[model samples]
Target: MTSVSRYMSYRGYQFPMLKYWSPSLGVTMLGVVGAILFLAMTLGPKPYYWPTDASYGSSPPIATRAGWMALALLPFVLGLSVKANMISVLTSIPHEKLQIFHHWTSYAMFLLALIHTFPFIIYHIDKGDMVKQWKTSLVYWTGIGAIIPQAYLTIMSLPFIRNRFYEFFKATHMIAAVVFIVFFFLHCDFRLSSWDYFIASGIIYFLCLSFSQVRTYLMHGIHTATLELLPSGLARVSVPTVIKWTPGQHVFVRFLTPDLHLLTAHPFTISSVYRDPDQAGKAPELAFYIKPRRGVTARLAALAAKQTGITKKILIEGPYGGVSTHHMSQFDTILVIAGGSGGGFSLAMVDEALRVSGLHTGEDESGQESRRRLQVVFSTRDTPMADWYIDEIESRLSQSTTLPGSDNGFETSVSVHITSKPDLTRSTSTLDSEKGTAGKLPPTDITTTGSFSLNIYRNARPDIPGLVARTVAMAHANPMPNGKKQRIGVLVCGPASMLHDTRNAAALAQKRTFGGEIEELYLHSESFA
Candidate 1:
């Protein structure tokens, strides 16, 4: 199918506002040029290129222009690749979006690198000294070395090859990065106009690396990870560290063991909020619900299944990437859709919303109206995984009584959908009352508390578009407590298909004005891969 048709089909309706905010090829190209101009302005235009003699148009001014442009863009490329990018931090743009800019900027730099190289060679050839320069100039050789590795790295970065051979790709990518920097510096040889860019890039990269190393050492030096293997290829890795993290954030973990090496650090969502009991000045604890995909995860799962008692050292990198603060408290209705192990992130979002709701009491003409309604829809192939999450939901709800007037708290609902074959004895065949369709369904309302409920269904997957539509309608039905318009936030962390469906559904919902009340829908997607 065509990409537009697939997008429209998933969207269910067109939403110009959401569509316009997406990244564009044209915009990226413009940004590339803008960035170059911004840097060039800093370097003050002079006679950037001057010929040694009158013939051949004074040595092709491109030699100097191209060299300076390449230098100016180097810092941007380096900074964007780092997790704690200064530009991203300052601009409040998510690192993921910065990564898109990073990719395009790299392409621009590659073009500049070509421009920087061939023009110098051609200018020298026009002077009839190309072979002599090549034979004697260390700068020439170093530039050649830098360009060759960079070109090789760029070619190997093709999606098919990178995904298929990730380990080799990672190793070579790092090596090539180091090689590029070393030769790039030597080739420039402290040229005054461009030295600042190289120095800035080096400083930024050094700080990022140093901070990561120091943070890992301080956080995990005294920590321990206890792994419990769960049903359906899920393993729970629990680490006692005292660092607090926002909901939906993730960390890179390196497990040091005979089976697992330091080279295998992988990112995983912190499935739960940090719990700090304030006991003996210890740090907060965190847990990860890991699915063994391949490589490091598979090896770790196997080791955990064996139940060895030896203490294993670990390194924890960060609590990186989270939902923006602007999107956190404004939403009146929050829908979290997760598939399989992606529940790790969704459940934490649910917990955060509930916690926030308890802290803030929304008051209006009608006193004390609960402003947040949180819905969790988790789909998995195995009943056991669903059962585990069901238990977690009940446990969290029971703990909510600690809040003042705790009996009446936020409105939270959970739905666990088992899409594969089901246990016939436990699940009764019923029709979906909301959809008015006949299907093999479980009880619509399996369990309920004062304002919390858990629904379980069998032999079906969630209709992403239908659920989003119904929820938006319900949210719009209630007027906002203050004069503000009602807002809905849809967050999905799952397989690509689930993320796509949830995103498109959100895009469609955001377009509706809801009688000029501006019922807004925003979608946040988290993918561990």
Candidate 2:
């Protein structure tokens, strides 16, 4: 889908539109729920009445139908719960992107579960055997057992609670899920075909779990990760490995250290592009730029602060979820926007752009001269982070400039904005901001480094919409030589606020594409928070 359709929202409800579902996703989910309800209501007992036979007890036709419907949803819910699964492999959709569906499906199952439970309770009460059934029936006990954990899983999984108590929630979520599944299986008591659902779900969940475990422990194996504290208070993790990963992908790192997130595996985006060891004459390294928060990052930062370049044994899983390299190459122009810690994401995109355009290898592709343009816009409140970013950009630009085919017309530009007040006392040679007549921090434009231009602004925020519009306008101004409309790809990684702005901006830019001014306007957004 184009950015326009993906980010489309109804008037007067912009905030709610940003919560989870896009209009397309919302409609798809609505259809799913509607179909479930239709089947439940249509196939069930007409008045949802309790059977006259006392032997039937709480096993009314309607209750059985509701239970069966809930059972049918098990496979999908379980399949989407894992990081590595057949669903993702077969569908070409990443596990993370399927997370929203996983959550919604579970909610639907819980609702059906409630529907299945209430009927039994009402039937038992009407028959005046509620107390007897509660005391004697294993089914009643096991049903309640399953529901307690299910309720906990549902309520605790809410965004606010899950994000606020993430460490606690993550630790307990797995345990609770196992308990709920076990009790749910027992509650079914091998009722015809019920065991089938359990087996399906069990297989799907275990297979994915086993694959992830094997990849983490046996395939990628254990490696030493060196942690260094940057002046920006960000932790830089460097790991040498033969494993290759696409740009914009992330890996879950499990540190083998006690009292320091020993049991948890935290995900970090790889900031460096992978190259062949044989070709480069050394093992390729993966780098992560992590802003210290709480838990694992906080502990890692503390250790790095004590002694720079501290090494820790770590297990890595994945390299998952990235825009396809081929898809990215199809774009005539690539604009990357990042905020704070999202610098890593932006850096990776820039690296990929350079590599794809043959600027890094100095190999000129036939008929590809001046074919691609890359723009990077990064905003941060910290000056040190901005400085670090500037240095990294300069290094890349310098390398490209010295290459044989560097002047192939593959244009690159970087803009860094620091929202906080600049420290005038710091000694730096790159600062080129003109002195303000009043007490104001004016925008600073750093001198062009090598063949690329680098601009830095102090005490200012980026105009996200303006940047997007200008990039699209530039692409429109330079029509493709092939007589085809130009394509622009925008990648945004930042906090929710920044994502919201970029999302809307990209969506609005789609108007030009729809009006035949361009071929396409694609947007990929990642939320760092």
Candidate 3:
């Protein structure tokens, strides 16, 4: 199928939205420019590229005000979106376009703000004599602070520079955002617009952001958030969520504590839909069955040691863009690729599938007659992490043996691919001791009737070829159930690099001309990195 059909069939969104939102930014370009035009039209002559309002000193330069409006627009647009979770607002745009908008608008904000500062700068440069008094002026200082963020923001906006120094860029990018917000309050002297759209926008941003903070604060009073290690190595964290998850999505995380400065919230694909709706004052509890990492996962480990209730506040905001397959009809073959923490999301889907597997399989199977296979490829860098949940896995596997209404899931197929096992400088137990355990899955593997197995290795680089090997081994295992187009769909989540390669692999595999038959493989990915 063509890209449009695939997207329309899977995502249930207008085809134009994806193509325009594609890295080349075909559509967002027009939208953003149009927004700029509207602002310009409301303010002056140059409605597209130039800022018409240059007046300063009086109240706020019209240009300055408009710049604030634009800066504020991003979060405002986000606040209203169903996906607005403070945790991963960065997930709003596609990678390439995200980079473009993140850079350009930021630089534009900086330039506009800087241009708006011109009168002040001219006035001050005229009087280096009045430097001391000028520097103390509220407007002057606020503009200066804004300038500080602008400089860093501008530097990071450069593609090559940002690529070269991504860590510093990310950190500074976040810092710049906070700084921008601070300078905004100073710019407005905190009263906010006081009424109308400006006030409404400001309030919305405040409530959206502050809601997360206040909810967490009330839940976990002092010691930072707690991480409860569930029995199956699935860490149960009661994050402050305002509502139910839309399913098949993930978010970025950051620690609330001061000491763990680098203890950012790692992105974990959300596992399940929020079951309760009427629960009051209770922020949604997000779940993650994390595959332990050494240095990076230390904070989660620390939380696993919690004795009673939540220690510190945990921030949660997100229902980021999720799987395209959320809307797709249940297909014949569903190949899910979960590497490391990626499994959190896929396993959640599998959990849902396992519960319904019997309804579609064996003697009494019904709706799933059209669906033939349930294939999963799990690429992990740790082996024992698998051991951590093997009990529950085995239980599920056994459950497959005895269908609720029948016997032996001779109908479906299940496969797990363990791509690698890296040396963990730290262990899950050690981490568990520090942070209290959350919860666990049962002790059983998931097995259907055909080709159930686990493949393991210790490779330094888990590349496309390796992934292709495992996936192909699973796909061609039984000749795609007698001549049906192989029709495989993949959902991959892991390191961004690995996900990209997996996508490439899936594409490569689909391009081949088979013997008297044709097959198509579809790939999807979620990146926490």
Candidate 4:
């Protein structure tokens, strides 16, 4: 599909305000439900049983059909579980993007398994052979064993439980999945086509797993990572390597330290843009800004606190899930919204904006009347984090201006909303030292540097809807030189509340595109918390 059609399909609606699924997802789900219903109606037991006088067996057909349907879903569940898989390769959808479908498919399979289980019990109990079957039949034993772990996997994967006990969940989820799959394969007991489904699932999972392991160990390999604790209570991990990645992509980093996450790999968004070493004459670095919550992060933070700069051996698995650079470059305006540790996400986008605008390339402007605009809206409660963010922005803007053939008309603006009171008792010197400042925090005073402007708001939250509306309004007010309507790209990375507000705002703005007020408005959001 074309990008425009894809964007429209994926765009969300505000009505039924709590609904999170896009039009595309809703339609896909509807199709899945419809297919399930059709299958159940067509293949379900006609009389629910055959008479003892008849030639056919007495067991209900619904149980066998449900079991087959559940078996057919195994390959899909396994395919979606892997980061590197044929589904993602064929569909051009990231593994992370397929996560929702994976979850739903697993739920469907679990439901089918339950459906498959109870019918056998009900039928055998009515025939007065249920207790005998349980005691004697291997099929009953294997089926029960499979369902028990399947139940654990399903229940523990619920958002609240999974999020609260992530480390435990992650460890046990794999073990349970293995046990369930093994028992399920045994439960089939050489049934025609049942083994085929298991074989397909196993092949899909193994190939994906092998590819990922090969990529991680051979292609990417191990690298040293410097971990520094930022004043905002975030661990800043910097790994200099020959590997290159696009803006907004994330990597799964396995820290090879016993006290830290020795076995498990944690995902973190890459905070810096990749520059080709051959072109730049230096190895590019992958940077990650991580907020400490629990488990691995908390341990990393504790280590970072004791030592300002610590080094560890790490292996990175991917450069996955980012907006296409070609797609992003088509926009006339770029608006980025971020909150807290989402500052890192915003920085990578800003870097890409500068690169796409030819600021990094030092290319001469094409002499258009209107400039390409890049606007950033950040909300945070940490004073030090706000300072650090401003410093990073200032450094980038300063570098852009110094580059040869920089565009004079390129406009950039930043609005930082600090949602908490600044601690007056904290030593300014300590803060300055951490940020490499001149023994003082950055002034709260509004500053305009050439084409760049910065605004700081103290003890207040950002007006998300207002910001989005104003941006669209400004685009409408200023027509492009070529007489084409403006195309805007809106990227947001923040908390769920922030994402919800931004999504609604963008949805409202998208209506203007239909009215000819704009050409297109594309929104991409990532939840940070």
Candidate 5:
């Protein structure tokens, strides 16, 4: 296999385990090219994808321009595919292929875009007519905006940042991308390429995103929700979606307007469910904690703020992420590490863990029978979001007493690390005691023998050395309740920093136990930022 092939097959995105039929990137590209080619052949000449001098506009100049332009577009398209294809699905294409294309092609695209624009600019400059310049003006600036961010996103998509300083890159990429795509569409005027195809591309991506949303909404619901605030700026809204979702599974949501019919959806794992305290049914109602930020969410917030009720519908799709939750019941104890609204996710699993076999104690409290230890280390800088979270925590705490399995009950500990704002200095100092939790819960010295974790850079993301050491410590200190060696699964969702650290920690832990082979493994990673 070629180096490019290797990169595509393995080095790109972290493929989440799922059972959906997703097409391979190679297949998708081939199909797209086929569509483009057929159109070009049918149309004959101008704007044709492939070339021949006399018949089609495949002159060396157009060919070079098109080829380079395609390359420049590679990063944006590839990067988008990578983001959209976050779940490790059953695709003819493995997750890595497009990433490779996205990475390498991005450079080619950047240079090609420059080629396409500069020559046109230079030729136009000689005429120097203000009216003529204004005519071609709109898309140039917009396309440039799109290109600049696409270029930066491509640079950071490298494994170094993609896997290492992922938090910053992820946030940067998402923010840049939303802005870029908006500009991208406007910049073109849909004149050069087949307008239908360009529109089709928008539809293609939107379809994937919309399908996920509609599915999720139908399954989850968009009405009657009580928003509770947790301690860490985490807001948990429990709505009754008639849909039943599996544990360790997730879905996409879009709560906009007629735009929801066109725009992409935001992804989130269901944090709490009411269907199966035992998780016995195929369907269930759920609760989700949302960390309000820019992008899709900010708009959702604006809509909510203006709303008189829960009429804003969110499109939801997928019973995606076939993450194994069996160990949840089998482990001696389950340790969950969550940040901000991520704590809501813990509540979902934690409620179930209390009832699962090994994790539960023999004694039945109030005759319901339950005993499971779930520790949530929640940290937040005092903000309006934090206020929202505190309200949720109080409500959940009040409701926890009634959750079937929680009769004997699990203790819900809220760790509020507040300072001025996003300052890592004084805040990190206060949070220092939370050192040895799964992804920084609390030091084992302050906690018990059942579980422990390591902190994920409360300041700047932990460097590689710090991460390696943290992974080592967590590996060595893995709590194996009842003194038995067992498989410990990890499901992390929050900032990209925690995901990276958790992934590395999980990997090393597996290696520490079995000779470098992942055993009984299930990892589900999602980034809210």
Candidate 6:
């Protein structure tokens, strides 16, 4: 076998288990949390500090200090919970990664609450005034109210419980959080100095959420979205909005017109072109490919399907995510791997690579012309999805070929794999000879009908590692104008297993020097869960 073929079949290197946990984010969080804890324990003014050896003597001041620390953590926990978070805006870190710090800080706050609770109780009991303290002080009762929910919140946040009952978890978590905040402030008796952080956290959350809501209203003005239910149990909802978003970013959508659960918004990746305007001076239209799963999506689909020309007043919360943009253009070649609905994210990136390459000109930081090779691999469970997305894939590829400064735009390839058997019982006897599928509507004839080609694989899935290796090899072998080291960016948005495979392949490639001695590989994943 040829060297290219040999390299493609080789299973590459795997990193140690700890690397999979995203060590950089972990390390950063550890340093920050440790510093905060150390300062809280050591540097704060100890107003109740005493040289007394008695346990009851130190309880009041230590508990009060811990209470302060717990309150201080509230802003960060709330900040990280927001989609349009200030920390992410400042740091340029994905909000998803920031969630790790959120979880840890919440635990820290819970620990502090525990620490804050026992000492005061010990002091009250030691003085034989426990019952009197509870009866006389609103602080004692309000503190109990705050601590109980905080403990409950932590219990309900366990991964297995959360994933199983997400809606319940979300509702209870929100309610409990609000209760905790209120009681926490009251527990401090609304002392502006002591309760200021909780108030700040509430303000931050309100501003972020309200800003997102107001922006959407300003752009779309209580927009009506047209929902068309497709045969594949997927519904396409298209809405015209004034805002433009980067490819692969998602918007949180709520169907205000729907009778069922109109308040709960769900995030869906924009499946259509990022900034396409159908006419001059018209609002850019956005589209979402939504599967009819349980909850709001399912209800929305059923409601839309029953009504002809269904239009709903919708709320769009954001054009969030797509942090991959920070480094996508730095690479010479791009490989996008996606599965099922996750194709929404991958396809957007594919479109972005094409759009930027066609539109970009002049020199880069390295004084090299804009040039890139894009390879798209989409795997789906059945043919209907494949058919729908494949048409979109072809249209985008064809559009790229004709765009201005697109001489190199045709340097793209699309491979679609369908894992399930086609419903051949519905197939017509006279199969379209041009397209391989025997069906009522044959797949697109890429050679005859499109400027670019699409390879459709049925009853099989592409070997993720092998395909990645071959693509990396091809990119490495191709010569760049400036002869700088080739960089390959592998962007995956799919099931966890698919992401794991793609990440593994990218990691393997990074270890080896490809055809060139200094070939580099970077992997970015968009995870819905």
The per-model lDDT (C-alpha) reads 0.71, 0.79, 0.51, 0.80, 0.47, 0.70
Please provide, for model 5 over 272-375, each residue's C-alpha lDDT reduced to its tens digit, 9 standing for 90 to 100: 64455355555456667677665544444554555424455455555455234566655433445555566566556655554444345554434443333343
Write the candidate numbers in order of decreasing lDDT.
4, 2, 1, 6, 3, 5
Superposed by TM-score, candidate 1 places the C-alpha of residue 415 at a distance from the truth, in angstroms, of 2.8
- After superposing candidate 1 on the true structure, give the runs of residues whose Cα lies further than 4 Å from its correct spot: 1-59, 119-133, 219-222, 279-283, 308-311, 324-329, 361-365, 382-384, 398-408, 421-451, 457-459, 480-484, 513-515, 518-520
TM-scores for candidates 1 onward, in order: 0.79, 0.89, 0.57, 0.90, 0.50, 0.80
User: RMSD to the native, candidate 2?
Assistant: 4.0
Give per-residue CA lDDT, model 4, range 1-529, as digits (tens). Answer: 2344543444454334643333343446665785678466536557655565676664567777778888998999999998887888998877887786787778878988887888889888878998899899999999989999999998898666788899999868889999999999899998887888988898999999999999999999999999999867789999999887888888898999888868788899988998878888999999999999999999989999999888999999997888888866777889999999999999999888887776332232544466677899888998888878877877776677675665634578888888888666766542221123332333353444455777777778999889989999999988677667889999999986787678777767867776789888888777765
Candidate 1 residue lDDT tens string, 1-529:
2233323323522335543223333344566687777456534565444656545453346666776777888888888887766776687665765776776677667777887778777677867989998899898898998888778776676555666777667656878888988888888888776788887888998887777778888644646788877754688888877677888888878877656756656678888775546744766668888888767778768877888433467888877887854576778888999998998888788777766665566564567465567788999887767767766765676577545555424567788888888665665333222224332344343544355666777778999889998888777677666655667788889976676667677656645643454456666778665
What does the lDDT read for residue 218 in candidate 1?
68
Output the TM-score of candidate 5: 0.50
Q: Candidate 5: which stretches are off by over 4 Å?
A: 1-88, 91-108, 116-224, 228-233, 256-265, 274-283, 293-313, 319-322, 326-334, 355-377, 381-485, 507-511, 514-523
Q: Of the candidates numbered 1 and 6, which has the greater TM-score value?
A: 6
In candidate 4 the C-alpha lDDT for residue 120 amounts to 86
lDDT of 5: 0.47
Q: Flag regions of model 6 displaced more than 4 Å.
A: 1-65, 121-129, 190-193, 276-281, 323-330, 360-371, 402-408, 421-453, 512-520
1 or 5: which has the higher TM-score? 1
Superior by lDDT: candidate 3 or candidate 6: 6
lDDT of each residue in 312-363, candidate 3, tens digit only: 5545444456654333234445666666666667666555555444444432
